[model samples]
Target: MKDDSTEISARRRYFRYAVFSLTALLVMSLGMAIVPRQPPAPAETPFSERARAAALADALALRAAGQELAGAAAGDGGPGTDTALDRTVTLLTIQARALVLPGDTPTASAGTGPGHRTAQASSAGVPASPGNSATPGPASLSELATDLAASGATRLTDALEADGGMARLLAGAGAAQLLAAGEIAALAGVPAAELPGWQEPAGPSAQPSPARGCTSAGPSGGADGERVDPGTGAGLGAALTATLDAEHQAVYGYQAALTRLDPTAATQASSLLAEHLDLADEAETYAALQCTAIPPTPPGYVLDPAFLGAPAAGLARLESATLTAFGDVVALSAAPARGWAVSALVAAARRTANWGVDPGPVPGLTLDESQLPALPDRPENAALTASPAAT
Candidate 1:
């Protein structure tokens, strides 16, 4: 079973303070609710009426939120949110202490000029505003924390709002921030090890290459569904060899089609074929780091240029040939090794189609996304060139 390692890891800091750190976040999140809001300035000219309404609303919201939090497990707080021990106590402490301050609102929201000074100095039935929105009055800070721990936040939105109104409480609330960071850190773990970010850590740039032991391409070489033989070498080298073979065949088929197509289409196919060649060369060089005996064969598969007739007919045959060759290579690969070759073939076939040459005239097999490059999260700029037929 997949453990909450990810979640727990995210709340590492909170976990550091107390084992029940996550519990705190969960409990507080459960109780979040919207307290009654202050009345609009137009509706209540007397600030006292608006303030009373706000307090009343806040109380109801707090009560409702508290009930919710009570039933939820700490699991509900999410990774790193360690709402229970860290956020809950911190927020509550702020609010509890804040309730003692005298102000128009939390953090000292007060009218400036002569009025505020008079209100502060005299306190003769006048409301003293907050010094800053970021610094809620002591009473507001305490109440706000109390409200959040009780029931005010449900989604991330609520949490943000609660934070906004509880400045004094948030002053020393670095713990909540840690919880969020912890969750993010946990998620970043696996991928970080496998695929380094732009700033990669430099270690020993050298590694011993695996020996190439196998002799022939295994019997599995057939269609898109074929697997590799256990007879071959492991990992990057085996994958590179397989891909290189496929690239060679694809290049050959593309050249065969070029002789039969219009000048424009032929030129395009030639360019794509060159790209495959370049990719193959790169794969071979990189692959040298893994295995020794990568069989580089001289160009053999091709039709006589004189036999090339109708552009359409030539393309149709070439596509069919390339597709079948792809299947054959795949059949020769082992299960783990098939993924790389499959990807190369699929990408080549798609680019071939961009030349407007459909091998379907000869029953070409369908290649799938599983055999191509990783799909973008959102393919906003997806474009397929007009096929030869379409043109």
Candidate 2:
């Protein structure tokens, strides 16, 4: 009987140990089931990458635009003679280049009041003023362009608008004033509507003139004075007004694209459409200031049927064409306006690329030799690099 009791006790102890082990195992299993699995490591943000590329591209473009403006200013034998505009251009150029070039410093002042400025040239030969060092990258380039554009717009606009300032600038009748006016306004982010007044009244015509320099003759006059050149004073303004008309047409194109784009693409298409509207409005503002009868937008644009079938491709083609148009005007424009046109070109190029189009080596300008097979033989091609007449 004692042995039986012992056996019962031993069996009971074994059962309790087995139950405890089973309970512990079950609890562990339940805990694991309730715990959440970790999500995959977050992917790199698409915006960040795009921002970097855009910044770099803008910096490069701004630098190029600046150089062109400075050169034009210098050619006028006014503010550019002292390299005031050139110095400013150089400073901005260095800052832009530094953003893309590794081991280069971005610390540079935009220069102090007017042309009397001091700065050292970067290794790339662009002037750079001393300032806080910048982290050389896309973000830095974008930030620089944004900050400079904002500050420039405010100060320059105020200077031009205040107490006969515009009148005084225009009265100077210097090439610096004519060419730099649009560029300065562009840099300041001034709207086209706010463009400064012209001291003289003039108009533009599409025909080419024989004169090497600008002629004050009527739009159809045969004299060189009738030709459209920066020296003529009237052509640049006319070209700008015409550009505004082109921008107006661009808005229509975007609107058409929005109708055919996919839901996913429509979101981007809408944003692009809005941008075109703003550009159109700005263009009109400038055109109105010229006192020219701004060309009204046509009731409808003839969009390609292929674009209606494939909205993306159509939009891309439209962007490319606009970029080319802007480039055509750039060749004819003087300082400030020329720079502004370049910015438009860059923006169009970016949009074109977004639509899966290759913008080519030069986004806006067709400087490619292979593309211009007959360009070399044309006597007019020599003037292609020269300042263009208002078309």
lDDT of 2 by residue, 1-391 (tens): 9999999999999999999999999999999899978889988644322222223332333343444445544556455332544543544343233224343222222311112212222222222211122222121212233333322222222222222212111111111222333445444465534532322112232222323233344223323332153333545446666567667667777887777778989999899988888767655544433334556568988877887888888888777777655554454543334444544555676677679875543444344343332211111101001000000
How big is the positional error of residue 259 in model 2, measured in Å on the Cα after superposition? 2.5
Q: Which ten residues in a row have the lowest lDDT in candidate 1?
A: 113-122
Q: What is the C-alpha lDDT of each candidate?
A: 0.35, 0.44
Q: Per-residue alpha-carbon lDDT of model 1 for 276-356, expressed as tens digits?
A: 787566456434433436785756776556436564445444444545443333444332233333433444444544444
